[model samples]
Target: METVRIRNPGMYWDIAANLHFPPNFDASKHYPAVVSNHPISSCKEQTSGNIYGAALAKAGFVVIVPDASFQGGSGGEPRWIEDPEQRVKDYRDVIDYLQSLPYVDADRIGILGICGGGGYSIKTAIIDKRIKALVSITGVNFGRLMREGFSNFDPVGALEAMAVQRSAENAGASQRIDIFLPASVEQGKAAGITDIDVLEATDYYRNRCPAEGSGTRMLFSHAAPAMAWDAFAFAETLLTQPMMVVVGDKPGGFGAYRDGMEIYGRAASKNKQMVVVEGWSHYDLYDHPVPTGVALERVVPFLVQHLGEAAVSRVTKPAA
Candidate 1:
């Protein structure tokens, strides 16, 4: 994979991306492509690039893993802002970049999104028809997660607080940022946080597989926009692209299992399929060798089958 920058029109920032080329790549020949999106607070070097991008490239597809605006190597101000609208638009910009490449087949493009990105991909495909297929791994619908996860939940109250913060920041108050995960499992345990998803997320992101530029924090002002967003809104009627929803069978942790099933049941695509990896949790599917292997085992064929027969024949066999 090599680094490239894509100009995000109307957004005024260039998106930093890692572009993965297939083995024996022929620049003169057009190839099916996949846009792999990383999770919230993750950089291209995380699962999206190192795992999925590499694997998909090996399977004969040109894959681009981009750092979302305001995070990673991407250019944006008031960094770590997790605005859902911009996130969805970033994918469209990625598609524009992919379509501009001579080696990429514009009509045969697909998207693969992990964690928070899974939700953004769904929202993007709902309105953008260029995405021919979608593969959502451990999908988390952020709006729903926030709505139900909070105790004494009150979106209005949260928004009200955000409004005040925004006003303060506009008048020179310091920007507030919130850490998305704990520093370690021991700290979480001591804090009396028993949720397996939270603990595992801390372990994986904070300790197990930490990466540069993936500081796992977001601007607090982003809450209002994210709280109002819904990744699956109008999906049942508008999401017509071929899709595969992959999630672990485990119960909790950002609601991937529930959201994946919701996506499967709601997507208008007649060719959609869902895979629940037994015994794997949400974070496990992020980089666990066994779980990621299980996911790609199905994901590669799905993309190949949907992208084209030519892609099927070009699929590279895994090395022994």
Candidate 2:
């Protein structure tokens, strides 16, 4: 377990990353690599992404966990600005670094994105052919989520509001917006929880995954309301790479999973798969044990199959 700080030219900032290598690492052989992106508002140290990175490293691949642009150890101004374009570029910049490493097999690079990151990862795979495999867990299509709030996908008013905010933001006026927190668990107020999904998200965010360093708060204030609008668009025509979209069967994620599947199904790629875990909710797939296990089982095998035996074997070999 070692942490390395890498500078991202794409975002013009430094990214704090954790690179976990198997107990035995060999410099002579190039290892397959997987870059794991964390959830929104989370740093690389979050248990969910860390657990997955450790799991992949144990399976013989060198896992790199890079802190997303505006949060964690990464550099960005006006923290939590939620720029989808910059987020995707951050992953690309990480890939660029991975390719430059002598011990990494450039052709066997893959990615795993969780929660909000899942959408970014999907967008990355669609645009960057360099990525050989992708797995999105409990994914959220930022565009859809923002346009149509949870349980509904209506962008009419949200889009208009964004336009209004964009104007205010351009004019250097600080916009006033509501900040939803897990502590505000009084029905219909949690940040990412939906009526359809389990109601435990409030507890999960407040108690289980409290933010570390800087502030332990779970929500943000006035986070560039325009970010949601910039996160997604009609990207159906851009994806041509293999992708694996995994979502819990519960209500919180059903809509998102369906949306992702729709995108995956229409992709021109010859290889794509969608897996839904029965009796699982969106938050359940975050750091929750049951959903995480189900996710890892599907993801590890998928990467192996798509990236090829040679790549997996190379990464898994015992260090001399």
Q: Which residue runs does candidate 1 get wrong by more than 4 Å?
A: 150-152, 309-320
Q: Name the candidate that leads on lDDT.
A: 1
The lDDT for every candidate, in the order shown, is 0.88, 0.69
List the pairs of residues colliding in candidate 2. Answer: 148-154
Task: Evaluate model 1: give its TM-score.
Answer: 0.94
Worst 10 residues of 2 by lDDT: 213-222
Q: Candidate 1 has which clashing residue pairs, if any?
A: none
lDDT per residue (tens digit) for residues 1-320 in model 2: 77777784544678778887865787667788889887665667765346788888887787888887666777876565666677788889889988887778999999888777788888888778899988887777765665555314645554566667767767897854333344445654535555654345555666677666213222123333433543335455666667888887766633566666666666666678888888877777777788789888988889878765433334465888
TM-score of 2: 0.81
Q: What are the TM-scores, per candidate, against the unseen true structure?
A: 0.94, 0.81
